[model samples]
Target: MTSGYLWLKAIHLVFVASWFAALFYLPRIFVNLATVPADSHAERERLLLMGRKLYRFGNLLMLIGLALGLWLWLGWGAGRFAGTGWLHAKLLLVVGAIGYQHVCRAHLRRFERLENTRTHRWFRVFNEVTVLLFAAIVILAVVKPF
Candidate 1:
């Protein structure tokens, strides 16, 4: 691989890791938000602010990661990853991650509106989706097991 390719790959990995960190934590925050007493307005508002900011930051990281990934896949390494099932699977998982993030953002909006209808238990289950998706992505990328 060219040094330029290596650099892009490294940057892509960094942004992905950052994005996943936020993805992993944000739902836990939602779980906490779900349990806040109706009268704990202060804590509820604080969690809502943090969730909004984290979602925006995560979105930025996703964009950077996607751009760098495209650069690696096409601009710098065209034809290199072609016909790889693992790459396809990884891409699908990445898309799923993005969709999951969108769902979280929607939940955040609901919380902001004081209209969240899901229980803390539901969020706890929902949060595990990230872990499963991340694990599958990593395994597909590293193992390339078809």
Candidate 2:
């Protein structure tokens, strides 16, 4: 592969890594934020703050990766997103990830009610989505569905 390909892949990997790491932690933080006891509202606050940071940073990485991927797919090649099936798969996974991020943001807003009603199981479901998302992203990038 050419140096440009190598650089593109490198940036994509970095962005993927950052996205997944944040994806993993953000949900856990959400789980914690949701389950925190009424008496421990302070802890809930902290978790919410941390989750916010994670979600924000994760989105930043995801966006940057999207830009790099688009550049690599279009400008580097014949045209953007022309014949890259693998890149298409990766793009789909990113869309899923972005959807999950939006869900997290919505839930974060609900936390303002201080209801603390969501259970660990609820978070587990969110966790499942991220896990699947991360797996799909990795597979698409590495396997390059071609």
Candidate 3:
């Protein structure tokens, strides 16, 4: 409840929210990439470049956010909550979010290699997964309903 704790929490929330923005949009980019006409090389390349840049930016944000969160938990004594069921569940979902980000990278690679076989509709569905994950994480953190 100290000022330092509040500041760290605020910064951590900022970076995490920024990272999620990238997560939410990247799949929509994938949907567009998937639907790009096979002959539209220029368009595909443009989207790929955007995706690559966004992915890198998102990675940086995620790293900073996670580092700050770790500091808040361990250094700032939020570790008091460590053994609680809600904290455990929240951590698991964080792991899932990381995995989801990497999965997006894999899809981007496939698209870059012109090996993507999924439809735009599939990518649309995939995009919703991030939303669900974010919602669950927020609920776990705020509600802490064990």
Candidate 4:
């Protein structure tokens, strides 16, 4: 039973890693594309496509991870999350990460109206913040800080 629990935990971590990878990259991708002259047709097309793909990939992966995360929380995560200060802190970090993702999605929707520089900066900050937030999550999970 413990082995099975570990297995589920592994799956949960895999998806969580995937979500973070996409989160970290998507904004950087935007940053690079921002330098392209907005009037360039080919460049704009490429960027639009990239934005769409980011929109698709980031949301889908996180959603899957979120679902699996909740499943794990209910099913296999109690060992970590069971009524401890560390667990509560980790859960709060998770919520912060997810909330930031939603904020990114909302910002992504306004991609067209905003200048590229602004978008790059905004999403870059978003990514950076999430990285720190997730680092805290990982620390709390692993260190089990009381």
Candidate 5:
């Protein structure tokens, strides 16, 4: 790989890591929000504020990371990997990660409206989904096992 490709990959990896950090923490916030006493208005409001900010930041990171990844693929000749099954699987996992973020947004909106019915345990499980997705994505990217 060229030096330029290596630099782009490094930057993309940084943003992707930041993005995944948000994904990993946002649901933990949800878990806390779910457990907040119904009468603790201040606590709920604080958690909601944090969630909103994190979601917005995460969205920005995801966009930058994805754009950089696309450039690396299309502009830096990584597109040659397009013929491989591993690339296809990796792309599918990327889509799933994006979908998972949206689902987190939906849950956040519900919490904002005070309509969330899910338990803390549910959010705990939801948080693990991102971890699983991250592990699979990394394995596919590195191992490229078909």
Candidate 6:
């Protein structure tokens, strides 16, 4: 691999890690927010603030990661990997991750408006999606089976 490509890959990995951390944590905040009583407005507000900040940071990370991935794919001859099918699967999972990020943003908005209705159990389940998706993505990228 070219040095330039390696650098881009490193950057991509950094941002992917940052975004996944946010993805993993944001939903846990939601789970906590869901359980907080309406009377505990202070705690609720604090979690909302954290969620908003995390969402912004996560969005930035996602953008940087995507940009670096594009550079690797189009600028560094990563097209050669296209025939392996793993890259395609990775791309699809990345799309799912983006969709999951959007859902988190929507939930953040709902919480901001004091309109969230989902139970803590629901959010706990939702939080697990990131774990599953990230694991699958890592496996596809590393194994490249097929």
Query: What TM-score, to 2 decimals, does candidate 2 have?
Result: 0.85
TM-score per candidate: 0.95, 0.85, 0.98, 0.83, 0.98, 0.96
Cα lDDT tens digits, model 3, 1-146, are 99989999999989998999999999999999998998999999999999999999999999999999999999999999988999999999999999999999999999989999999999999999999999999899889998
| Cα lDDT tens digits for candidate 4, 1-146 | 59987787788788888888877876676665666675686876676678678767877888887787777778775755577889878878888887877766665555566543465566567568868987888888778879
Model 3 vs. true fold: TM: 0.98
Angstrom error at residue 2, model 6: 1.9
lDDT of 3: 0.95
Error of 2 at 133 (Å): 1.5
Model 3 ranges off by over 4 Å: none
Residue range 1-146, candidate 5, lDDT tens digits: 78988999999989998999999999999999999998999999999999999999999999999999999998999999999999999999999999999999999999999999999999999999999999999899889998
1-146, model 2: which lDDT tens digit per residue? 58978888798778877877888887788777766777897797788888778778988987887788777767777255456887777777788888888887877777766654678788878788888888887887677668
Clashing pairs in 5: none
**Each model's C-alpha lDDT?**
0.91, 0.78, 0.95, 0.73, 0.95, 0.92
lDDT of model 3 at position 68? 98
Model 4 spans > 4 angstroms off? 77-80, 114-123
Task: Compare candidates 2 and 5 on lDDT and give the better one.
Answer: 5
- Residue pairs clashing in model 6 are none
Q: Show the lowest summed lDDT stretch of 10 residues, model 5.
A: 1-10
> Ten consecutive residues with minimal summed lDDT in candidate 3?
133-142
Q: How high is the lDDT of residue 138 in model 2?
A: 85
